[model samples]
Target: MKASYSEFVELGGQRYHVRRWGNPQAPTLFMLHGWMDISATFQFVVDALAREWNIIAPDWPGFGLSAWSPGGYSLLQYTTDLDRLLDHYSPHAAVPIVAHSMGANISNIYISARPQRVSHFVNIEGYAPVPEFFEGSLGQVVGRWLDHIAKPGQGRPYADYARLCERLQQSNKRLPPERAKFLASQLGVMGDDGLVHIAADPLTRFFAPISLHREQLIELWRGMSLPVLCIRGGRSFISKAFEHRQEDLQERIAALPQGREALLEDGTHNLHHEHPEQVAQLIEALLEQ
Candidate 1:
C-alpha cells in the first residue's frame, strides 16, 4: 500500500514531524495516535478512506520524530502544543479530528475546553484520563516524579528490526504481521550498537503529577455542541474500563448535541488498525453528515 511521507516543522519551540497524505488544499483531517505510537500508525486507516482529504498526522512532542520538551509531559503542555499546531495549520476554521488512546484523551479535554476549535471529533477507544483513573495521592505523585527524575532516561533497544516488529504484534493480537512490520520500520532506528531503538523519548515513560478532574471534563462535555462519533472495540480493555463507570460514561456521551457511538464486533483497542475499511466508511459518513 502507498503511504504518506514525513516532514518536520518547528512549533512551540520544539520540532514536530508530520506524516501527510492526499492534497494539501483538501479539507484537513487531523489524526492523533495513542501513547508510544507514531504518525505512521494511521497509514492503513488513511489508505482505507474513500474520500479525498488532507490528512495530517503529527508525532507528539517526544514521540516519533518530534523533539522532546525540556520539562516532562503534562496534559496542559500537550494541549497547549496542540493549540499552537492548530493555529499554524487551521487558523480560521474548525477542523475534524480523529484521535486514539492518549491522543483522544488530550483532544477530548481540548475540544471540551475550546469547543470552537473543532467541528467534529471521532474518539477511538479514548475518552478522558480523568482523576478517577489515578490511584495516587499528591504525595505518591511527587514521589514518582522524584524517582523518575533521579533515574537516567533510556530507550529500550531491540535485538533487531524483526524482533521489534514481533514484539509489537505480540502485544496487540489485533495487529497483523505486515502492519507490525510497517510500524517497526517507521518507529525503529538503529543505535550505535547496531540494536534497534524506538524513535521516541524515554522521558515519556514518566508519570504526570495529575490529570483533569472528572467533573471538569463533564463540564466541557456539557458545552461540546459539535458532532461526536465515539467508537469502541468490543474486545478492548478501554471498553471494559468505561463499563466500570457505565452510568457516567453514557451520561457524558448523551450530553453531546449530535453524539453517536459504534462498536466494531471483532475490534480491539486499535480498532482503526484492525478494521480500517470499516472505520473509513464510518468516517466518510461522519464527514458527510
Candidate 2:
C-alpha cells in the first residue's frame, strides 16, 4: 500500500477526517467514496496508479473518523461540505474528481452548481436515476422519515476483525483475503462494548424526507460542460438497475455535454476495489485526455 496520512479539518462546524496520499507536489486528485464507506476505501486504487498524484479523500461527516451530525445527513449538506472542502484545498484552481456511487451523485450535483470548481469527473456507477418505486409524496416521505427517526437503526457489531473480514468477503467475493483484512481494519471501529462496529453513523440508514426531482437533476447534469467518464461494472447490481431501461440510462449519459461510458465486463459495483489497476488506468486516461 502507498504511504498515507490523515488530516482533521473543520467544515460547517463539523470535524472532518481527510486521508491524503502521495506527494504534495504531484497533480491533485480528489477522491470520493460511496455511502457507508470511508476515505481509506480508495487505498487500492491509489496503490495501483502508475504516476504520482496527490490524492485527497475525506470521511464525510458521520462516517469513518469524522464527527457525526445530530441532525442526520442530507444531499444539500454533502454538497455544502464539498463546496467548503474545495475552498480549503483548491481555492484557485479546478481539479479532477473521481467518485463512486453516492459520492458520484454528490459530485454530479456539486459540479453542476459550481462547474468552475471541477475540471473533470470520473463517475463510477452512480448516474442511475432514482427508481420510481422509491419516490413518494411529500407528506408520505416526511411521515416515513419521522417514523424511521423515532427508532433509529444501529450498525451490527462483529466479535472481531476476523469476523468482519469474513463479512466483507461475503459481500464482495472478488475481494482478496489480504485486501479484505485491510478493509476490516479500517472500516470497523472498536466500541466500548468490546465489539467492532461499522465506522459510519447508524443514522445514515434512515430515509431522507425529501423527494428527488429527476428532471431537475437531469437539467443539472446537462449544464456540466466538463469532461466526464461514466464507468459501470457489468456484473454489478447497479447495472441491473438499467437492465430493461437501457435507453433511459443512455439518455442520462447523453445529458452531459462531454459524457461517455465505459464498461468493465467482469467487475462489480465496487470496481475500484476489485479492479484498481484498470480503474486507475481509466482515470489516468481521462486526465491525460
Candidate 3:
C-alpha cells in the first residue's frame, strides 16, 4: 500500500482535514466520499489503481476530522467549499473528480454551476435525491427542523474498536472484515475516556429543509459541459427510491452533454470498495475517453 498523509487546510474560516496519496506532480484526482464517510474510505480503491495520480480527498466539513459547520450544512455550501478547495490546489486548471453518494451530488451541481472547473467526473450510485423529499411541503420541512432543534445532537459511543468494526460490517454487508476494521479506524478515534465514536458532527444528522425540484436538478445535469460516467450498484439500496423511476434517472443522466452509465454485477452501494479493481478499470476507461 502506498503511504498516505493527512494535513489541515483552513478554508472559509473552517479547518478541513485532507488525506493525500501518490506523487504530487502527477495529475490531480479528487476523490470525494459519501455522507458520514471519511477520505480514507477510498483506501481500497486507491490501492487498486493501475497508474499514479495525486489523489486529494478531503473529509467534508462535519465529517471525519474536519471542523463542524457552525451555521449547519447546506448543499450550496458544499459546492462553494469544493470551489475554494480547487482554487487552493489547482488554481489555474480544471481537474477530474471521482465522487460517491452525497459527494457525487455535490460534484454534479458544482460542474454544472462551474463547468470550466472540472475536466470530467465519475459518479458512483448517486442517482438523484428522492423526489418525495424534494416535493415535501414547506410546513412539514420546518416542523422536522424545529424538532431537530428541540434536542441537542449527540454522537453514539462504542465500547471498542472491534465492536465498531462489527457495526460497520453489519451496516454494509458487502464490506469484508478487514476493510471494516480499516474504515472503523478511519471513521473514528479512541477517546481518552476509552470509547469509540464517529468523528462527524452530530448535527450532520439533521435533514435539509429544501431541495431542488426534479426538473431543476435535471437542468443542472443538462448543463454539464464535460463527459460523465455514472456507475450504479446492482444490489444497492441507494437507488431503491428510483426502482420504479429508472427511466427518469436514465433520462437525467442522458441529459449530460456527454454521459455514459454502467451497472456492475454483484456490486452494492459501496461498490468502489467491494470491487475496487473493477471500479478502477471503469475509471481508467473514462480517462482514456
Candidate 4:
C-alpha cells in the first residue's frame, strides 16, 4: 500500500479529518466518499492510479474521525462544509473531483451553485433515490423524522475487530479478506465499554425530514457546465432500483450540458472498492479527455 497521512482542519466550526496521498507537488485530485464512509475508503483507488496525484479526501462530519455535529446532519450543512473545505485547500483554482454516492450528490449540487469551483466531475453511482421511495405526504415525512429523533437508536456493536471484518465481508461478498481487514480497522473503533462500534455517528442512520425534490435537483444538474462522467455499477442495488426507470436516470444525466454515462458490468455500489483498477482507469481516461 502507498503511504498516506492525515490532517485535521476546522470547517464549519468543527474539526474535519482529511487524508492525503501521493506527492503534494503533483496535480491535485479531490476524492469524496459516500454516506457513512470515511476518507480512508479511497485507499485502493489511490493505490491503483497509474500516475502521481495529490489526493485530498475528507471524512465528512459525523463520519470517520471528524467531529460529529450536535444537531445531526443536513444536505445544506454538508454543502457548506464542502465550500469551506475547498476554500481552505484550493482557494485560487478549480480542481477535478471524483465523488461517490452521497459525495457525488453533494458535488453535483455544489458544482451547480458554483461551477467555477470545479473543472471536472466523475460521479460514481450517485443518483437521487427513486420517486417510489419518497411516496408520502410532507407531514408523513416529518412525522417519520420526528419518530426517529424521539427514540434515538444506537448502532450494533461488534465483539471485536475480527467480527467487524466478518460483517464487512458478509455485506459485500466481493470484498476480499485483506481489504476487509483494512477497512474494519479504519471504520470500526473500540469503545470504552469493551465493544467495537462503527466510527460514524449513530444519528446518521436516521432518515432526514426534508423531502427530496427531484425536479429541483434536475434543475441544478441542468445548470452545471463542467464536464461530468457518471459511472454506474451494473449489479449495484442502485441499478436495480432504477431498472424500470432507466430512462429517468438517462434524462437526469441528459440535463447536464456536458454529461455522459458508463456502466461497469460486474461492479456493485462499492465498485471502487471491488475494482479499484477499473475505476482508476475510467477516472484517468476522463482526465485525459
Show where candidate 1 strays beyond 4 Å.
130-132
How do all models score by TM-score? 0.94, 0.95, 0.95, 0.96
Using TM-score as the yardstick, the better of models 1 and 3 is 3
Q: Which of 1 and 4 is ahead in lDDT?
A: 4
For candidate 4, write residues 32-105 as lDDT tens digits: 99987899989999999999999999999889999987677766678899999999999999999999988987
Tell me the lDDT of candidate 2. Answer: 0.88
lDDT of 1 by residue, 21-127 (tens): 99999999999988888888888988898878999899999888889875678777889878988888899989999999888888888997778889988988777
Candidate 4 TM-score, C-alpha based: 0.96
Rank list by lDDT? 2, 4, 3, 1
lDDT of 2 by residue, 28-91 (tens): 9999998888999899999989999989999888899999887877777799999999899999
Q: Lowest-scoring 10 consecutive residues by lDDT in candidate 2?
A: 127-136
Error of 3 at 99 (Å): 0.6
Task: Give me the runs in candidate 4 sitting further than 4 Å from their true place.
Answer: none
Q: Residue 139 lDDT in model 4? A: 85
Q: How does candidate 4 score on lDDT? A: 0.87
Clashes of 2: 0
